[model samples]
Target: MESLKYHRLQQRLGYTFVDQKNLQLALTHRSHGATNNERLEFLGDSILNFVIGEALFKKFPEAKEGQLSRLRSQMVKGETLAHLAREFAFGECLVLGEGEMKSGGHRRDSILADTVEAIIGAIYLEAGLDSCRDRLHSWYAERLAALSLETTVKDAKTRLQEHLQSLQKPLPEYNIVDVNGEAHAQLFTVECKIATLSQSATAQASSRREAEKQAAAAVLARLGL
Candidate 1:
């Protein structure tokens, strides 16, 4: 039953492991035991960066180094990886400990993202770099196809920074004004201040990073950019 459950994930990944233990280990969370997927996640992160970097380099000969770096970052970031994990129904196959499982750790973005990377590492170890590359390419086909120098999907912070840089204006400043709630789930209130603008934008989210992003987006909307 356990093996059959993972077989479904393998089909989605488009690669089956020779030694199924690799896949099992890759899905194991640190909370599950000492022998977990952390090492595999690290290896997979490096491989993912290299593979995505090489792909971007070939796909866009005219792109600058910064552009390629941004593109690769966008592709390999936790949010993107978590989205891929959702696509593969990874939450159902994650091997979390009793506490983590009870607390809905399987649905966590970080855990899902880490598991995806671990799986990548497992594939690399099982076969080779070519297999890993092929799987990544297959998985990221739509996202890769959508990439373009002009339409690069950038975060609000990056876009705001670039906008300020182009206009020779002072960069925006972010300050955390307030934090509410407990340790596990806190609401952060961040204010984005622009030197030229008379008014600042404030936003709140579950994390400081997200709050800052929302504030930046609000500032951008004010600027009419």
Candidate 2:
């Protein structure tokens, strides 16, 4: 990527690096070469968990430990990180190897998510924890504002399972009904079957995990739980 692109990215991140090289390495993927972003990713992941954990604790003082943990998990998951990456157009700045480049690694969720963490690490190394926390807050402002204990009491699957367990009912089962589309843009159709329900709840999404979540969500609606 060009210097102009990095400058634009820094503008989006709300933090400019004292040493631009750190940012460069943060944007580098392992596929690019040996000295890549893996270590930085490790550091950044820890920092993010700590920073977000503290933020959640302060924002939701009444939340129990389990609620806080689940909320943090949702925030730091690969899906949410990838969403943040897309917000900053991280794909345009990622440095990938030839093979990964040709295979659309720039748009891959795991890759994008890792780069976001790497960037967080880079920011900390260039400046300090305060800068890193500020950037995270900027990126997550809308999401933080939207969080509610009622809406995220539990994930759809967890809620469904708990409802069943409460009544001494058997657990729900999930199956892959179909998978379609190309390698990078595939869609998964998952069916959720509960012993008490006459019909199965089905949903489709870009990944099996997401598909299952949707299917579980559908089942939640069906059971009115």
> What lDDT does each candidate get?
0.91, 0.90
Q: Which stretches of candidate 1 lie over 4 Å from their true place?
A: 165-169, 176-190, 196-211
lDDT of 1 at 151: 64
lDDT of 1 by residue, 1-225 (tens): 998998988998888899999999999998888999999999999999999999999999999998898899889988999999999999999998887888888998878999999999989998999999999999999999998987666789989999999989999999999999645446799999988799999999867998999999999999897
Clashing pairs in 2: none
TM-score against native, each model: 0.83, 0.78
lDDT (10s digit) by residue, model 2, range 72-173: 989998899999999999999999888878889899888899899999988888789999898899899999999988755677888888999999999999
True-structure RMSD for candidate 1: 3.0
Minimum summed lDDT over a 10-residue window in model 2 is located at: 179-188
Which window of 10 residues has the lowest lDDT sum in candidate 1?
Answer: 179-188
Question: Could you tell me the lDDT of residue 210 within candidate 2?
Answer: 82
